[model samples]
Target: MIPVGAYARVSEDKALRANAADWREIGEQVAEQFKDMDALAAELGVTITRRYNDNNRPAGDPHIVRNDFEALLVDLENGTVRGILFYHSDRLVRQEYDAARINRLFQLNPTYVGRAVAGGTDLSTQEGRSMLTIQATMGGMEVYSTRRRVARKNKGLAERGHIHGGPRPFGWAEDRRTLHDTEAEELRKAVLAIPGGLTVGEIRKQWIDLGYEPTRNKKKPGTQTLQHSTVETRLINPRICGYRTYLPQAERRDAKRPWMPDFVVRKDGKPVMGNWEAIVSPEEWQACVATIEERKRARVEGRAAHTTSAKYLLSGIARCGKCSFPLMSNQYSKGTASHERYGYRYACLTTLGGCGGVTRVGPPMEHMVEEAFLLEVRRSLGTVAGQVEINETKHDVRLARIDQEIAEVSERRRAKRISMSTALDLIEELEGERDELNRQRRQLVAAKVRRQNISPSLPEEWKGYSVSQRKIRLRESIRAVMVHPAGRGRRFDPSLIEVVWIEGGK
Candidate 1:
């Protein structure tokens, strides 16, 4: 018997409507469709040699890359199969372009043919091609119809003051319009407390402490936590203030113009009040918004969040002598009883995590290190600065010469005096020299400027350097400042601090 191939497709959306118990039921449906193709093959006196089934697949677009369809096409082109069988032509292709592709294949391979079991259509005949084309056109129309139906339904639901379909919001019941009493009460209490100096982070911690659980939604499975961002988001939503803002899918896609969920939409020249109870007054909501803004300003200004405007002098350079991990600066509140004792310290990550025990007081250690560094710089400033200036001048002169040579070579190449290959080689050599000189010039200029910026005669010039500027100066001379902790209850010692000097440093 002549070998034939069979193809079957069933979309996930269709199987879901059929009330498929699981993927197994969908697989059974696919197998049943293949049996129909097998029956057709038996009638045609051809054995069903290979079967291709695309379960949970979309056939609306010809441009979509279907794995099984491509494989079947590969087999057909290789002349492994003389005929192809399908449950229906629409299952093989829904788009007109896909139908044209099938027609092209039949033209290329005259012996190859397509037969659909349901419609009894054949690709080998003109009348059968017409039938397949009409079926595909109708299938494409059905996709558009489905989309229009969904769009109309969603728009109607939105006008009725309800979200089309999504997971229920935190304070709302499954019906959406009705508020969940307990959740609403908790939310109201949280929002009310925000302006009273309680932060979003603090509110989250309070909710966790009180053992508050999140509302369960069928659409979103898994336990959810009341995070700081979540609290901040809930506080800012206008839904709690009794207004609905209709944000379409298109509006949400424009990232530059992000849809603010807290904004109230005007309908018929008036604000559309949501058909839900308000959790808090609009005035209270605005207060919460103001509080969040104030917190953000404070963090950026470094008045909060324990960050310093000045760079920590030894941030990346300092390492724990025991674990070899970089030391991090720890900031403490000012004017505490132990402000002078523990205000600032360089604490190792390993030591903090109980891997080792090494920490250094920031102020005293930094003061000692800087005093020693500056003294050394003062001793060699004249000799080092003069050499850097001379090297910078030499690099500039050589770079000018290299540029002139490159221009001469390019002009020669354009004039056809030298072969293209010879001109390219010379130009490449000159460009390399120019790059090297530029790099050297940058290094020498930076060194010269750094020395000029530092005035040994004026002690105040040293203090004028910002935290980042001081770090740059220190890095040039020091590789690492390895801190060995002084024993517990012992006096601070500069002898314990080991400053490893960088190679060729001042």
Candidate 2:
């Protein structure tokens, strides 16, 4: 009927950001620390009633109300933990005040923070008190020793050219180059259809229309599953092009464990460049990788233009859906007006004056509808800002290699290594690679061109320009603006405005 408690602290280096818990290691450690308490309780015929553990926390971190460890410490103060027992003293208190309080729970502690009730074995006994003190000191040593061992082992592994284990890489089997013909061929098709080629959208559309299905997730029929980004990554994978890479450290929160020392391994259980057939040529792979990096650099170095006016926020996108028409925007005329409101509305255009009249819209009504729609959108889909990261060096090397291939091919033709027909064939081969590179190059070139030759970014309150100027900027940035007419009035019904797939977060 007596209650006793157990307490434990894990080694400090534990981090749970990887979404994995070393629960097994933790359980074992806790058992080791509380071993005495369990034995003592059995001897006294008392039950160990509670256990508190600081899981995945460093000892030095602040103990806050929201933190689990803080809650456990509070319980200790309230006598919920009869006589706090832990593997060690340092675990209970890294700071002096904390350690002193924990040591005072009982004249003779039992290493068992067992029952707060009266029937537990007497901790005031000489043997019981000594046993608890020895265990705490031992636990402290264990923590320090564990850290030193790990650091030494890691250093040795790095020197031996061995990468630590990590997430399975694509194309290879669990970090090995073992062959899986089916998946390999799928990868082949993916890289072959690179950027600007039948887009993943086009490829999937063709596949689905012809009744193709993936081995996984087959329940959903007629749905295209090749996301644009996924296919894009396949095209740039070094393995696809026959070269194996060693990514000793590639860790990002969204990416595989970033900053963690890991080596590139084939999917099958071998090292990269260990054993495998090259899927795509190195040249093509490099080209794709290069373009990706260039685009990323441009975007990162490129700043975003700020929009200050509400009209600029919803301008081209706020359209009516009835006839798929865009609503015209106008402000209140106030040169001499007594009561003109200053708001914006998107009303469907009226028919030719001969037949009837233009539809009318009011400003305040437009704001009401726009704000409500925005609120709903924000609630349903949380605001997200996606960042694009690229391995710059990898991409740069890839692009240079592709350019080299093209140059080398041209040089061979000039030297007449083969006949005209053969030369033409070689040129075609090189041209294929060149064209791929060109597409990526064009995207970058276009960006630079826009910066140097094109007009500056337009202002939201572009009262400086006429409607004609606004139309030009809209054409530059927008694909289309559609509007639907409601039965009555100059007021735009926000319900009729349907915004389609957009690139960034709204």
Best by lDDT: 1
TM-score of every candidate relative to the true structure: 0.46, 0.37
* Best-fitting candidate, scored by TM-score: 1
CA lDDT scores, all candidates in order: 0.70, 0.46
Model 2: lowest-lDDT 10 consecutive positions: 303-312
Query: How many pairs in model 1 have backbone atoms within 3 A of each other, for residues 3 or more apart or on separate chains, i.e. clashes?
Result: 0
How does candidate 1 fare on TM-score? Answer: 0.46
lDDT of 2: 0.46
Could you give candidate 2's per-residue lDDT for residues 1-506 as a string of tens digits? 45646656654433433444555235554555567657666766767677666654555322322244466556656656555444444555444344334445554344534331222323355454444455445544665576567767754553443544544344546554554546666566544433212233444454445554443434566675654445445555555655444432112324653211122233322223424557665444444454344444545775212221123333444455554454455554556341244444444546411112223344444344344434434453423245133222333454456556656777887898767787678767754664455445535433332223222222323444333234333333344444444575345455544444334323
lDDT per residue for candidate 1 within 289-343, as digits (tens), equals 6545555676788644533223577777788887777788887568774466757
Cα lDDT for residue 315, model 2?
A: 47
412: Cα error in model 1, Å = 66
Which residues of candidate 1, in runs, are more than 4 Å off? 1-6, 10-32, 47-58, 61-84, 100-107, 124-138, 180-266, 271-340, 343-506
